[model samples]
Target: MRTLIVTEFISLDGVIDSPGGGSHPRAGWTFKDVPFVEEAYEIKGREQLEAGAMLIGRVSYDEFAPVWPSMDDFAEYNEMPKYVVSSTLSNPEWHNTHVLRSLDDVAKLKQGDGAPILVHGSATLAQGLAAAGLVDRYHLLVFPILLGDGKRLFGSGDPHTRLDLVECEAYSNGVIKQVFDVVR
Candidate 1:
């Protein structure tokens, strides 16, 4: 079976809502005004190229589509196969992008052939995938900030799922990168 990795740039408090100044209320909580280190960018660049396909939620898609397409830094992501999990959005203007209407569609995509499906910045979809027991791995990039009120990576309406830590690393800037495999 292919691996489905969910990658995230979250805060110390597990807030993954808007690490990139997204419209979400939790926006700018991660590194808010601070600039990222060169190592962080390098790591992200590597992850972007490593994934066979990328999956994202509607909110994330909206926030990213407009920018990534124009970003010279994320050329890999712009060219990769992208799957957007959206319920209401009918038309997506991104290249190599497809819309998944339901959880069933997501499962079907996961079953198909390709490189591992890497999910990024889609908390709602992540919750659903986690609850449905579809995720195979998680790559969490934990930043060094804390936000008391923000959308969490997991909790609230999500089902209980245990994760086994497969690997972990800590950067000098206090960025903790943890890779977890689903315990199913």
Candidate 2:
């Protein structure tokens, strides 16, 4: 079986929205005068290269498709078998991209044995995956700041999903990387 890993950069208050310079009031919180951890790149680069595929939500696809394809540093993301989950996205122009129309499409993709399937910065998709019990692991990079008001990882109405922490590492910049296995 393939593993589905949801990776996110979240604030201490569980806010994962617009961490990458989005127009929110607390946007760009991930890189706003914080201590830089050099090792983070190495860790993330490893994961990016190790992942077999990229499964992103519509919102994230909109934000990323234009930028990621043009970047040279993100070669793994640029060349991977990209799956965008969106009912509205009828056409995807990015390289090696495929449009997934439903949750059933997502489930079908995970049926075969392969390297890990990675999902990044897709809160709605993450919630849906959690609700459907499709998330195998969560790799959360928690920043120390608290963005009091923004889109969060878990909404009040979302289903309760328990996770077991399998690994955790704290950086000098007050950023913590936590790896959790979704408990069945």
Candidate 3:
């Protein structure tokens, strides 16, 4: 069976909406200074190379499909199969991209034998997966900042999902990377 790993770069105050620039005022907060340590790059590279495919939501796919294909750095990410979960999206323009109709399809995908499926910057999808007990693990890179007002990683009504810390690393720039396994 393959693991579905949901990853995000969240703020101290729990905001994970836009680590990259977006509509939020603190959208580009993560880029204020380089927070990545050398080891961070190594870890990310390994994750990218080893993952069999990426599973993203419609919003993330809309954002990434336009850029990743043109970047040489994301070659590995682009080459791997991409699965976008959406009800509205019918035709995906990006090469090697597939559409998953619903979260139920994702649940089925988790039962298949393959490399781990990676989910990045898909807040809505992550929330649904977490609520449905479909996520196997969470890879969170928490930056030292407080975005007091923004869409948070966990919504107020979201059901509690307990996680077991599997790994943690603090970078020189105060960025903390933590990997947690969903307590099933």
Candidate 4:
């Protein structure tokens, strides 16, 4: 079975919205408060190297499609197969992109063979995957600052899910990398 990994740059208060610049008031918080530490982002490089495919929600696709393709830093992701979950998205212009309609489809994809499907910014999709128990693992870079109001990585009323810590590291810049496997 292919592993489904959800990765995010999250604030200490659990906010996962707009770590990169967007319309959110606290948008670009990741870059604003945290000093750039090349070593702190090593997990991102590792994720790109390990991921065989990318799975994301429509919103994230909309946010990333126009930018990621041209970014040299995301070349691996640009070339890899990407699956976007959305009923409304009929056509995807991103290279090697496919549309999956529902979480049921996501579950089916998880049954296929591959290195792993890495999920980037897809808060709603991640929540659904967690609630449905489709997510296999999580790679979180927890930033030290707190953004009191914003969409969070985990939502309320979700089914109880257990996680086992696989790895963790604290950086000098106060960013922490944590890898957790969803315990089944």
TM-score of 4: 0.98
> Per-residue error at 8 for model 3, in Å?
0.7
Candidate 2, residues 1-184, lDDT tens digits: the string is 8999998988998999898776688778788746778875455787887999999999898899889888888898898899999998877999999999998899999998899999988888988888788899988888999888887777787777788999899888999999999888
The estimated TM-scores of all candidates read: 0.91, 0.95, 0.93, 0.98
- lDDT for model 4: 0.94
Number of the top TM-score candidate: 4
Against the reference, the lDDT scores of all candidates come to 0.82, 0.87, 0.84, 0.94
CA lDDT, candidate 3, residue 84: 94
Q: Of the pair 1 and 2, which is ahead by TM-score?
A: 2
lDDT of 1 at 106: 84
Better of 1 and 3 by lDDT: 3
Report backbone clashes per prediction. Answer: 0, 0, 0, 0
Ranking by TM-score: 4, 2, 3, 1
* Tens-digit lDDT string for candidate 4 (7-112): 9999999999999977679899999989988999999999999999999989999999999999999999999999999999987999999999999999999999
lDDT string, candidate 1, 1-184, tens digits? 5578888888888888778777667577556544566676555777777878889988888889889999988888889889898878877899999988998998888888877888988788888889888899988888887777777888787777788998788877778888899897
What are the per-residue Cα lDDT tens digits for candidate 3 across 86-144? 99998899999999999899888888999999998877888888788888888888888
| Selected candidate, larger lDDT, 1 vs 4 | 4
True lDDT of residue 175, candidate 3: 85
Instruction: Please identify which of the two predictions, 2 or 3, would achieve the higher lDDT against the true structure.
Output: 2
